[model samples]
Target: MIRTPKKLWVMHRIGNKLQKINNIIKVIPEWRQRYIVNNVEGVNSKDLAQKWASYTRDSSLFIKEDDIVGIEDESRLLEESLMDGELQQTLISVVGMGGSGKTTLVAKMYNNETVKSHFDCYAWITISQTYIRDELFRSLIKEFHQSRKEQQPPELSGKDYVELVNILRSYLDLKEYLVVLDDVWDTNLWEVIKVALPDNHLGSRIMLTTRKEDVGSFSSGVISYIFHIKPLKGSEAWHLFCKKAFSSYPDKSCPRELELLASELVGKCKGLPLAVVALGGLMSSKKSITEWRSVYDNLNWQLNNNQMLEVVKSILLLSFNDLPYPLKHCFLYCCLFPEDYIIRRKRLIRLWMAEGFIQRVNRITPAEVAESYLMELIFGACFKLY
Candidate 1:
C-alpha cells in the first residue's frame, strides 16, 4: 500500500538517516508496487479521470472575496493595458506565486463595471494543467453566448471541433473582447487557444495569469507587458487576516484580547494571502479567545517540532509520487548538482541518458525521450521551467 500521509511524514523524519543504505532502494519500489496492487489495481479510467478532474477543480478554488484588501494599483494597470492600447491586440500577463491572490485580482478586473462597459464581450477560462482543448472551446463558446444575450448563437453542441473554433472566431469578429486565460502551464495549450482568438485590431486584449515566471515570460509576446505580483505586505496581510478571522463579527476586527495572538499567527503565514485568509476562516469558527490561542499554539508547536517541514515534505512527496517511474529517477538525480545552480537543459538530458533514466521508445532517440520526460515534470508543476 502507498504510505499514508502520516506514515510519509514519519519517513520525512528519517529520510537523511537512512541515506547510507543503497539496498533500501529495491525494497521501497517493491513495497510501492505491492501497495498499488492491493489498494489501487482495479480503478477504472472514468473514475480516475473524475478523481483527477475533481482534485484539479478543488485545488483551483476561485474565491471572490467580499473585501479586496490592497490591489488598486493592479486594478488600474489591468484597465490601462486593455484600454490604452492602439488597437494593437495587446497581451497582459499577471504572474504570481500560487495562493497569492492572482485569481482574485484578475476576477476583480473581469467584473469591473468600467472595464465591462469598454469591451464588447468578456471571457474567463481557468486552464488546469491537464485541460482538454475540446472542452476548452465548448467553455469559450458557451461564455460567448452568455456574454451576448441578444442572440442565441448557432448550435455549437452538434458541431465538430474545427466548426466550433470557426464559430467562436466569427463571434469574436471586429468587436473588442477582453479574454482572461488563467492558470496556463503548457505552451502547447497556448498554441491551440490562440487559433480561436482573432486579434481583429479592434482594441481586443488578452489577460493571462500563471504561477511561473518563465511561463509568464514566454507568453509575454511583447517585452514590457508582464506584471509580476508581489506577495501581500505586512499591513495588508493583517488587514486580510482580520477580515476573515472575524467574518461573523459586524466590525470584522479581532477583539483586543486576541489581537496579539492573531498577529503572531498572521506573521507565521509569511504574508501569503491564501494562508492568511484560510487562517481567518479557521479562526472565524473558533468560539472563544482560548480556541484562537489553542490554534496558534498547536501551529507554533508544530513549527518548533519541525512538523511544518514534514507537512512541506508531504506536499513535495505527493508531487514526487505522481511522476512516472523512469522520470522519478532522473528528477531525483538532479540533487547531485549544487543548490541554486543553473544547469543547462541539453547537459541535463545527457546526464539523464548516462544514468539510464531515459528509456528507449519506438523510433525515439534517448535525448528526445529524456527531454520530453523532463518537460512533462516541468509543466506538471513539479519544477519551474526556466
Candidate 2:
C-alpha cells in the first residue's frame, strides 16, 4: 500500500511537469507570431525603432508653460513685435537653428491673452518642409472661421485652391488678422502664400519660424523684423537642465554630489534648449553617480548613435543638410578639427581651397567663394565667432 502511494506521487509529479511543458508549448506560437510581426511581416525594424524613439522622446519631453525655461525675454520681445507693430501688414520671422525654441516662443506669443485681444482673428498654421497649397488653404480657411466661432461655408469642401485662397482673403480683408506659419523652409512658399494674405492696412501680422536665415530675410526684408533666437546662456542652461533632470526630486533640484557631473552633461548640450531638456529628461531616471559619469563619458557617442538623442541629431542635421554641396563639404572638413579648436578664418579657407570645396564664380574668386561659404555657415548658426 505504501509502494502504491509512492507510485501515485511520482505520477502526480510527472503530470505537473507535463502540464507546464504543454503551457509553454501553447505560448510558443504566440511568441513566434509576435517576433514575425515585429521583425518580419510588419514595418521595417529600423522604422519601428525610430517611431518608438520618437514616441518615447515626445512623451518624456511634454512641455508645460511653467516648465518652459530661458525664453521669458524672447517671449516679451516677440509679443511686442506682434502686438505693437506697424499698422500696415507686417511679416515677422523668428529665425534660429533647430532645437533653439523658435516654435515654443512663437507658440507662447500666439496663444497669449494680450495677443488674442489685440487681433481680430488668429490662424496658426504649421508649414513644414513639404506643404500642399490646397491643403494649406483649407486649413487656413478652417482656422480663420473657427477662431471667430463662425461656421465654415457648406461648400468649403468643394472649393479649389484659387477659390479657397479667395475665400480666405475676402474673409480677412477687413479684419486685423494674426497668422503664424511655423517651420517654413522655402522662400518660394512665402512668395506664393503672401498673395493670399492682404495687407488691409489694419496692423494685420504674420509670424513665421524657419531654420534658414535666408528664408527669414526673404519673408521680412527689414533686419529689425527678423528675430534671431540664440541658445540659452550658461546660467539659464544650467537652470533649465536642473529643472528637467531633477523634476521628480524634492524642489526639482540636483543633488550636491551629482551637480558636477550633471553640469558636464549639460555643457555637452551646448546650451541648445531642446538638447539640454532632452538630455535632462534622459538623465532623470538615473540616480547613481556611476550612471551619471557613464553618461558624461559616453555622451558624444550617445548623441551620434543612441536613438533617445535622435531628435537632437535630426535638429542639428537640418542646418547641415540645408548647406549647398560645396558648403556641406567645407562644413564636414571643419568637423575634422578637434572640438573647441580655434580655427583661423584664413587657414580654414586655405584648407577648403586645398580640398577643392570652393570654385570661382564669374566675378568672385575662390577665396571670395570660400569666404561667402563661411558667412553662410555663420548666419545658418552652424559656427559661432568668438
Candidate 3:
C-alpha cells in the first residue's frame, strides 16, 4: 500500500526519536549518586552532574556536519556496530580512491558526540603504505593517556614486538574503545596488530579507511557491512564546485554562458567531489568562456598525452584501470553520450545489449545483465546513477 507524505514524515520523525533514545540509554552512566562521603560513598547532585558532563564531553567523537557531504547511512551503520553489546565487533572499513572522502567520513564518525559518550576510550592512527609498528603503538598509547589520566605505568615495549602487543592487550583488556586506522594499505599489518586490540568489550568500535577494497576486505574478514563511498550527486557536485569556484553560487551575474559551460564540465566529472574541487580551483578566476572551453579542450588533450595533469587525471586513471576488459569497452562506448546528457538507463542498456555486451551469461535476462554491469561500474566509481 502507498503511504501518504504526512505518514512518511511522521514515521521518519519517530525513527529518529527512537534512535536518540537508544543512544541516550547506551551512553548514560549506570548509577546515580546522592552525596560524597569521603570519596568512596557518593557526590552531591550538582557535582555528580558536572562530573558526568565532563565525561560526556571528554569522550565525544564527531566530524563537523558542515564539513561532511553525504553518507548518513554509512554513519548510522558504524554507530550501530559500536553500540552493540559486549563481543560486538567495532571494525568498519571505508574504501574508495584517494581524495574520495574516506578519511572525511571516518573523521565525522570519530568526532561524533554519541561515539565519545559511548566508548570508554578512543584512538586514531594514520597507517600508510610503509607500516611502522612502533609509531602506531605510540600514537594509540598517547591517545589512551590523553583520554584517561589514571597514569598506570606505560604498557608498551620499546624493542620487543611481542611484549608491546601484550602490553596493549592488557591496557585495553575490558575497556570499550573506538580506534580508527586511517590510510591503510597493507593487509598483513592489520593481522599482526589485531591481536593486541581488546575483544568482547561492549560499545567498542574500530574503523578502517583505505583506497583499495582489498585492504578493507582483508582487514575486516570480508564482512557483510562494507561502506563503498561513491561520488557526489549533481546538485551536490554543483554545490561543491560553486563553493570552490566562486566566493558564492554562480548565477546570471556571474556570466550565464560561462556558468552553463562550467556546469557541463562539472557533469563530466561524474559527480566526484575531488574532481569537482580540483577542476573548480583550476578554472575559478577565469572571466572568459573561451578559457572554460580551453579547459574542456585541454582535458581531452591531457588524456591523449596521459603524463600528468595533476589529481584529476590520476583519479580518472584509477577509475579506468579498475574496469574489467569487457566493461572497459562498455564504458569507453559511453563517450558517445554527450556532456550533461541525462541518458535513460533502460535505453542505454538496450543499446549496450544490442552492441552485444549484455547477453546469454547463463541465460540471465538482458535487463538483469545490464543492471549488473551498471552496478559494477558504480562500485568502481566510474559512473554515476541518477
lDDT by residue (131-162, candidate 3, tens digit) is: 56765776677777667765634444454677
TM-score of 1: 0.61
In model 2, the worst 10-residue window by lDDT is 52-61
Any idea what lDDT model 3 has?
A: 0.63
Candidate 1 achieves a global lDDT of 0.67
Off-target runs (Cα >4 Å) in candidate 3 are 1-64, 149-157, 219-224, 249-254, 294-299, 307-386
Q: What is the TM-score of each candidate against the true structure?
A: 0.61, 0.64, 0.57
Deviation from native of the Cα of residue 25 in model 2, angstroms: 28
Candidate 1 error regions (>4 Å):
1-66, 150-155, 220-224, 247-253, 297-386
Q: Pick the lDDT winner.
A: 2
Residue 307 CA displacement from its true place in model 3, Å: 5.7
| Tens digit per residue, CA lDDT, model 2, 169-222 | 898888999898878888887778877888788898888888898888885432
Backbone clash total for model 1 is 1
> For this target, which candidate reaches the highest TM-score against the unseen true structure?
2
